[model samples]
Every structure is written in C-alpha cells, then in structure tokens.
Target chain A: GAGVSQSPRYKVAKRGQDVALRCDPISGHVSLFWYQQALGQGPEFLTYFQNEAQLDKSGLPSDRFFAERPEGSVSTLKIQRTQQEDSAVYLCASSPDRVVPISGNTIYFGEGSWLTVV
Target chain B: SQQGEEDPQALSIQEGENATMNCSYKTSINNLQWYRQNSGRGLVHLILIRSNEREKHSGRLRVTLDTSKKSSSLLITASRAADTASYFCATYFSGSARQLTFGSGTQLTVLP
Candidate 1:
C-alpha cells in the first residue's frame, strides 16, 4: 500500500465483547504505532513496534489491550473484554526506516478503526 | 501521560484571517510535530521542528520551537474553511523516540 491501511474502519462492540483492529503499514516501513483518540481529544500513544520486535508496550492502557506485529509488516490490536471507556478511534501509523520520526522520515496515519462500545 | 498541551482550546476566525495555536511540553524532546485532524477522521502530519532548529515553514504553515521555554507555536497563514480542524502537537522524547506523545489539542474553526 502507498500509505498505512487499517481494517474494520468502524466497529460496535457490546460491553464485555472482544474486538480486533488490523493495520497494514506502508511497505518496507519498519516502525509501526497505535494510538487511541477519544472524542474531541488528541491521539494518545498506545504502543509501538520496531519491525517484529515489540520494543515498547508501556503505553497500553491496560492488560486487556494487546498488540502484535509478528511479521514486522501487518499488526493487530486486540481489545479483550471491551468496556464503555474503550470507545475511541484506534489509529495506526507508520514511519520509514529504523525509528519513529528521525529528521527526514514522515509518519503516515490510517483513517483509524472507530470502536463504539455499547 | 501526555507530554504536550496545546492552547487556545478553541478558536474561530474568518477565512482570510490568520490563526495561531501554541503548545508547551514538559520534557526534553528530540523533535516536535504538528498534526491536524478533521472530525471523525485521521490525523495529517503538518510540520516538524527539531530541537536544534528554531523554526520551519511549509506552504501556509509556520512552526516555531523554543526548547529553552519548552514551547512551540503553529501559525496558519490565510486560514480557510478547509483548515478548520483540531491541531495537535506531539513530542518524541530524547530518551524515548520509539513513539510520539500527543497533547490535548486545539480546535480551530475558520469560517468562510
């Protein structure tokens, strides 16, 4: 893909139900990131991956949230036992090369997976 | 926790007027980036200013960084209705550059 792609653009999950959002980053981009944005708020970092290595998962809100990029290209963010507070847009972004936003590398974001917990 | 906080929580102006938004951070950052998000849409990267750089310009956007003051400002020249959106400032920490930490954001409305 020419840019980052996210699947399940919108999802409605009942409380306690689980949901999975998928992300396909730009080809050959080694860094991927996930963010959660509530209504009228800025996106917050959820997690980050450097290729297949989950270098940082410190930003995950709780144990119920899990993310993985096994092959270093496609990633999935799974929210288990979803709660009402989990209602937010999950954004996937990717940048070229080894790190986040070095000098010249630009980070591109997907349209996001909107999750509505009802 | 969020590293930056953008201000003028909300602003409204005419299409031809200029709009400026400011941001302040609490830590040493490797770089700061500005992003704009439309309602219910994704964010678009606007501009970036490294810690060593004081300012940068792109199209109608101008970004200024003051590491010593831990602040930055984004100025939009000749705002348009299409420029009405929420702007956010994100920081990549010098010690932690794996991801970006975003701010609360500023909602700018440009009336045509």
Candidate 2:
C-alpha cells in the first residue's frame, strides 16, 4: 500500500468481549505506532515498534491491552475483557525511518479503528 | 500521559482570515509536529519544528517553537473553508522511544 492501512475501521464489542485491531504500515517503514483518541480529545500514545521490536508499551492504559509486530510489517492491538472506557478510535501510524523530524521524518496515519465497547 | 496542551479549544473565523493555534509542553522534546484531522478520520501531517530551529514555513503554514518556554504556535495565513478541522501538536522525545505524545488539539472552523 502507498500509506498505512488499518483493519476493522469500526468495531462494537460487548463489555467482556475481546477485540483485535490490525495495522499494515507503508512498505519498508521502520517505525510503527499505536494511539488511542477519545471523543473530542487528542490521540494518546499506546505503544511503539521499531522493526519487530516492541520498544515501548508504557503508554498503554492497562494490562488488558497488548500489541505485537511479529514480522516487522503488520501489527496487531488486542484488548481482552473490553470495557466501556476502552471505547475510542485506535490510530496506527508509520514513519519511513527513525523519527528525526528535523530531516523531514514525517509519520503517516491510517483511517483508524473505531471501537465501541458497550 | 499527554505531553502537550493546546489553547483556545475552538475558534471560528472567516475564510479569508488567518488562524493561530498555540501549544505548550512540559519536558524537552526532539521535535514537534502539527497534524490535521477532519470528521474523526485519519490525521494528515502539516508541519514540523525542531528543538534547535525557532521557525519554519510550508506553503501557508508557519510554525514557531520556543525551547525555553516549551511552547509552539501554528499560524495559518489566509484560511479556507477546507482548512476547518482539528489541529494537534505532537512531541517526540529525545530518547530511544520514537513515538509521539499528542495534545488535546484545537478545533478551527473557517466560515465561507
């Protein structure tokens, strides 16, 4: 794909149900990131992946949230025992190389996966 | 936790007028970026300002960064109806983790 792609653009899950969102970054993009945006708020950092390495997961809200990028290209964010508070738009972004914006390093975003946990 | 916070949660102006948004951060950053989102969809990259550079321009967008004050401002000259959207400021730390920490954002409405 020419840009980042996300799966299940909209998802509605039961309170206790589990859900998984997928993201396919641009070809050869070395950095991938996941963020959660609530209604009328900004996108909060969830996790980051440099290649296949899960370098940072500190921003993830809780242990129920898990992310993985096994092949260094496609990534998945899984939420177990979903809660209403988890309802938000999950955004996935990718950068061609390291995030040194001074040298024109820009991150491209996907349409995002909107999850509604009832 | 969020690193940046934008001011003036919402703004409305005529199409020909200019729009200005401000952002402030708490800690040091490697770089700051601006993004635009429409109708709750994907976000588009607008501009970037590094910690060392004070100002940068791209087309009609001008960005200024002040490391000492930990603040940045975005100025849109001659706004258009198409420019109505939510603008966000994101900061990338100067460490190993390369992800961005975003602010609440400003909603700008350009009336035609």
User: Which candidate number would show the highest TM-score if scored against the true structure?
Assistant: 1
TM-score of chain A of each: 0.95, 0.95
Q: State the lDDT of candidate 1 residue by residue for B26-67, as single tens digits.
A: 989888999999887788999888889999999999999999
Best by DockQ: 1
For the predicted complex of model 2, DockQ is: 0.63
Output the worst ten-in-a-row residue range by lDDT, candidate 1 chain A: A97-106
Fnat for candidate 2 (0 to 1): 0.67
Q: Candidate 1 chain B: minimum summed lDDT over ten consecutive residues — where?
A: B92-101
Interface RMSD of 1: 1.8
- How far residue A110's Cα lies from its native spot in candidate 2, in Å, is 0.5
**CA deviation > 4 Å runs, candidate 1:** A100-104
